[model samples]
Target: MEKMLSVWKTAPKAGLEVKEAPVPKIKDNEVLIKVKATSICGTDLHIYEYDPWAQKRIAKNIPYIFGHEVAGEVVEVGKGTGGISIGDHVSAETHIPCGYCYQCRTGNEHICQNVKILGVDTNGTFAQYVALPYKNAWINDKKIPHWIATAQEPLGNAVHTVFSGEVAGKTITIFGMGPIGACAVALCKAAGADKVIAIDRDEFRLGFAKEFGADVIINGATPGTDTRKEIMDATNGLGADVFLEFAGAPAAFNDGLATLRAGGRASILGVFPKPFEVDVTDGMVFKGITLTGINGRKMYDTWYKARSFLSTGKVKLEKLVTHRFKLFEIEKGMQILQKKEGMKIVLEP
Candidate 1:
């Protein structure tokens, strides 16, 4: 019997129990991974809190493991699997897209109409063993640290967001200092952004932002005051040329829109609590701002970009990792993330 941890019920509040489960069976085109490391994400926090979105998407079951940021060593490969073998280090794209879909054929598989996110739609990696399609697995430099390997999912988000727009030599303001926000700061700076400004309410996260090459760190407590003022002042009173909103709060989106420079590009990577109104007419017309939205990474395409960014050595992941926990102690990790104090938190299974 393969033992695993599963979220049987929504936290309904904050704390949820992990139920032990048997290891999953693998199909011919899939591989079984013994998870070495997994990271808690913002979505996991929302799942813990039993949000309406998760309620609709996640099946109501006794136990449902919800971890997408994962890395592991291949333990078994079913018949017909290619190249990958036992002991190979790997991380998955989480999103398993059906190649037959229109979006998939058009090269937009990331948003394929028929897509299944491992952690959300099916059994995820918060266990000793998980079965995944061979196509979604990505092999990295064997020397890559397990901690850094688990971060590929979030880092890919940073790549997809910052690189999608014109970021080179432009002043950019990042609206959140969460894990992905911090990653964006590093990506922006490494991509030759003229300046990088990080905004967040947490002083610790803001301080951590500095290590990620943030030229300026602003506290978002006084929304309409110093933070916004500093961002504007840093951009020659014009406002940031690009604003990447990683904070899911509506306030952050509003502030991002207001603080964007005329003809600037804005990328929205955050998931808001619910549908909130944004006065698009306020600055969208006058500013001529290009607003971009992000979903998951574009599988192999984005993964290749992210890996290149890491291989460059210009983007640092060492200092960003501040906390680590074991798989059974996932509860504690969740608590730390909920408190929003640490920079990057990793969990070992």
Candidate 2:
């Protein structure tokens, strides 16, 4: 039996366990990968806390493995597979869209009606051995380390958000300095944004945000003397031309809207737990702002952009990796992630 780290349902709920599971077998047109590195995402924290999203969406009756950010080495390739060889380093797209879906046929496969996410719907990368369909896998240059390869998934979100609208030489303000938010800060700067403002409650994170090239950092929880005003003041009193919300906090959502200049664009990439009630009359409709919600990025489009960003030295991924763990220490890894104010943590299986 091969040992796997899995998110399982135990009494008191939200409980995840690491168990010794049978190694998976691959089908034709598939490859078996021995996981080398995987990262804990913000979604994992919600599952750990048994948030409403977890209780409602995740089936509690069965053992579920949760992880999507993964990179590994191919150990076995099934029959009929081509363009891949054993020992190749790879990462995969998590949104496995059914090609026959209406959205897929319309060139909107990112929102395909029938989508199977790797970790959430089935056993994911938390295991030592994971079998993936050939279509999901992408080969990386040999120099790219497994840790950086696993990070491509989340980094793709940053790439998608920054490029959603024109970012070159634009004034960008990012709210909620989480990992993805931090990624946005760096990406915006690298993309030639004139200014990038990083907002968060933690001073430590804001400090780290500077490492991502945040030109300005603000603490959002400082007893409310109008933090938006400070952001505007920092932006020469015109407000940010683009406001990106990476923190799903309802307050951050509202603040981001309030901080945008008239006719500016905004991107919402963070996952909020509840319905956000914002006054569309102000800043949105009246100001003629363009607002877009971001989901699982454009599969191949974002992938190509992210790989190019990594390969061309636009994004330095090594700075984002703050913690590492062997496969057996997954529980400890989860505990560190629960604290919430560190850089990326990679689990090695």
Candidate 3:
């Protein structure tokens, strides 16, 4: 057996174990990739911490490798993988759609009824190499660097959220400063948003969010801070034209709605721990606001938009990548992530 170093959730508990495991073998319809760079994601954090959600969903598959965001080079091409050849640079779409589903048949494969996430439902990419179906591999432009390519999957979430409605000349307020929120800031600027207001508790993240083109920054965690008033003031008392919810908190949900203008739009991608209360009458019904629940990227549509920004240099990810470590140093990066002290941390093989 050809062995490779992989990070695995060896026990049904928090933390992962790095070990020498057999390199994944590709199915006839799949391709084997030598991973160049991979990034830590919030989903990976949930699994690593063995949260309730991870315990319920991932525990059954306890001893599998776990990570999804990745960029790599094809090293072995399976016989049935059409058009994909050795040495092709690729990043995968995390949503693995079942081609025969109704959603897939209707061009909404990203929401395929039988969708199996790349890392969650199957073995994943936190290793020297990863293997997956060729359909999920998106070939990257040669000009894109490895770290930037590793970020494309998460960046697609930001694209799906920001572009859910009109962006050009609109005042957009994003609640959260995580990787996706950081990506949202840069993406809004690239799309020509007039003003981008960023709200977060973490100063470290807010500091760099400015460079990502956030016009106004607010620390919502500060005691008695009136984030709604600040956002209202930034938009000339008209409230923000759009609200993006990525904080995954009840307060952020209310703050987002409270600051949104009448008839405005809200795109929610945040995953809440559980359901909570809200004032729909005042915040939504009377206001006639449009709310779209974003699940994942719109398949290859979001991929193209994200690539255009990277290719044109409209969104530079260098600053967003706050820390880089060798693959074996995953612990250091995970600690920084848990402490909310790092943005997009990449690990190279």
Candidate 4:
């Protein structure tokens, strides 16, 4: 491939541009994949909106291509890349880690200090072709739908968060109804959770939570609805045994922790635009709750679990994918996503 179609953030301002870019060249340890399907992520939305977080993190990298989630076919493989070949169907692990880092050496490469993200830190998969480190190219099951394959990376986030603590028979509350939060609802149900409570400001996303088996769905934005009290009441006043926070809202953070039972676990995977204050002593220390800040999939562990759930039909993704468009129609996808009408929007090149 010589020239490629891609969505680009060409300026430090809001919005993106779809234009032609040179097909990425693969290094000795990399592979080139023809993108068959790709999807937008919340991170992509931030970059497109050029929020404060985007301004501080990626504005300097203007004229860059950004999008991480994808499913594609291997078109070229470098000499040093083994266990992967041309024609292999694949999805990518978006976290590119430096193997020699302290965290990487300790089997926690998911949090490597020098990690580089696919879309945020480098050129990404929202193009006709992309070059990726062979180690990060996850060979997909040929039977998995291309659109569904694009979600495996994000699904891994849900799986990691759900399983980070004991989930069986526990009451779990997820404070966001985004794609990942929806997946967490399904995961908790499939893993034998006794009750699932989902909270979100958007009614559209809350609908997915209901379909995925949340025992109670609360619209925190609904006129004067007390979300914290609703969650506590749903959990029989003991509060949730586990709280998974993905809303990235300050109120959600404080309320989620305050409602969690003492000695319970909380897994937070959201990226807040800015740091906010919280009552740490009463919220976490005095309560003796466990909190884990998830960054990316846990190296390859989450990958294996995510693949098993997706390929075997254990967790359905087709329903969660509410919109689709050509890569050229990225503007439409972005609009729908911003309106909260689309759950996970897939783009084809």
TM-score of each model, paired residue for residue? 0.93, 0.94, 0.98, 0.97
Q: Stretches of candidate 1 above 4 Å error?
A: 4-14, 222-224
- What residue pairs clash in candidate 2, if any at all? none
Model 1, span 176-249: residue lDDT tens: 88878988998998889999989888888887688888998888785465666777788889999999989988
State in Å the error of residue 251, model 4: 0.7
- For TM-score, the strongest prediction is 3
Instruction: Supply the TM-score for candidate 4.
Output: 0.97
Give lDDT tens digits, candidate 4, residues 1-349: 4899999999999999999989998899999999999999999999999988899899767788999999999999998899999999999999999999899999999998999999899999889999999999999999987888998876899999998999999998899889999999988988899999999998888999999888889998899999888888998899999999988888898889989999999999987767899999988999999999887788798989888877777689888899889999999999998887899999999
**Model 3 reaches what TM-score against the true structure?**
0.98
The local lDDT score (0 to 100) that residue 124 gets in candidate 2 is 81
Candidate 1 vs candidate 3: the TM-score winner is 3
User: What total of clashing residue pairs does each candidate reach?
Assistant: 4, 0, 0, 0
What's the distance in Å from true for residue 191, model 2?
0.7
**lDDT minimum window of 10 residues, candidate 3:** 310-319
lDDT of 4: 0.91
Report the lDDT of model 2 for residue 329.
77
